[model samples]
Target: MTLAASDRGVVEPSGLMAHYEPRRPVDLGATLGHHRRGAGDPCFAVEGGSFWLTLRTVAGTATLRLSPTPSGVRAEAWGDGAGEALHSVPELLGEGDDWSELDVSAHPLLSDSAHRNPGLRLSRTGRVLDALAPAVIEQRITSVEAFRAWRVLVARHGEEAPGPGPARLRVSPTAAAWKRIPSWEWHRAGVDPGRAATVIRAAGVAAGLERTAVASRGGTDVWRRLRSVVGVGEWTAAETAQRAHGDPDAVSFGDYHLASTVGWALCGEPVDDDALAELLEPWRGQRQRVVRLVLASGFRPPRRGPRMTIQDHRTY
Candidate 1:
């Protein structure tokens, strides 16, 4: 298999080197881009035309770098959990995502999008707290504010990554570390008390939450468990489920903009959350996939209000 010249220079242990050949082409960016908290996120990076990710795994910390090759994807990992990290490459790249249930023929736009971007698929990280914490930080805030808060808090508290990744990359903070973040630090990071408290509460029961991902009780149970956490609601749980379980149907129900965006793309009119639900019912089991198609279709509703401004809770 032909690989980038840069892949040749990496000398790693047998356990740290691995590759995944997807049956069909996969769009790494479209599938995994949501995991990036922001452009400056210390836990993720896209440099030298490759993707870098650092995670706190069950075994230990790991840094993984993925590069696409003609045959498939080449992955190299470092740290105690390198083997575990390498093993997760396929799932992380959407290898297990089943699109057989998706029938987009009912909607011409969705049909065209499905035909256009066959490589798009939802990714599963299989780490609950990792997904939930960032989602909580993002609640009720502009993306700019949430992303900035994540960047600051992670860069300040997260550990150094194990691999020879880009200088900016770091491992995401562990549950304990997240729980231990002081109030002043959260304030300094511009994460309001409500969001900060939610993250801390969830981190306290992170093991239980992570277990829900591997449980066979189904996505409904996973959603219920996630929502049980104080302050975690439909939006946060759906966002976490999308990444942690690669749940195909976990639509972001309460998102401020999702209903409107999906509405405009599907029916040429903006819709409220209730209307969006009814509109998307036709694709119940693959709603998130349809959402992805709508987003990728480049259709946007007319702006009816000013863009939400970035806010600093510290200043308030």
Candidate 2:
């Protein structure tokens, strides 16, 4: 995977180590659980690359180090914002953030989740729009399918991360780059043409969409504005909020499985969206964060129904 970087650099596989503890910035549960979902963790899959990062929740600190090789960015993070800077690359990829100023406890959702994953916290700071385009494309699909398609699409069209190694180092493509993707390529990534069109349309207005998330009022305003795009909806916006804005209230309401997951885990019966929302309401503004805690606590409902089927649009 050829990586693209604003800076020229590289890394030799054997040379890599770093520590991190992003102050009230990282969603640590996402880092440890989401399998490349969180930016704090190194994208160490590329050959000839190594990484190290640590979390210190009580202190609100993170550190970072990036060793650029001929191929990609070899990174190490330690201190208060190390993990933050690394995971925050999406900002550089057309996502933006003013992380220096944020208040964690000011939001009830964050205050509680910080207790849940003390080392990880999401302030009113982050790039909410970066995830919107791809996440909108992921609507109604199984996560396995969504991630697979995302990985494939990104690997194929995105440029490499600028650093060092023979590894595939690519950052997510710019808005212009994504808009230029061919129809056949989207099909190969298991994406339908309809979703592809939505993503392409979104990419064209990517900067404007991102701006909506950080506007003065609240995350809701951003959510409302993004849905103005043809293919975007509550579910898609919810997914984006979880990653982009760190919105605690952005519960994934229309999910086919989440209601069941929450019901079985907490109430032991499959509930509908209303029921799940009722159960989660006490957490209100931080509903998403509470859900994250519930998920992270390692509680899963006992298997009952048929498993979700995986569909590959490429074969058609």
Please give the CA lDDT of all the candidate structures.
0.84, 0.56
Over 1-316, each residue of candidate 2 has an lDDT whose tens digit, in order, gives 2222222211111112422222133433243233243332122232223332222222233332334343333445444444454553322222222222333454454445445654333333244434665676577778777777777776776654433432443445567778999999889878899899988888888777767654332366777777878888788877776655656567888987889987776667889999998987766666765676666556678788798788878887
Candidate with maximal TM-score: 1
Give the per-residue lDDT of model 1 (tens digit) for 120-171.
Answer: 9788888999999999999989998888888888889898899698988878
Candidates in order, TM-scores: namely: 0.93, 0.68
Clashing pairs in 1: none
Please report, as a residue range, the 10-residue window in candidate 2 with the lowest summed lDDT: 7-16
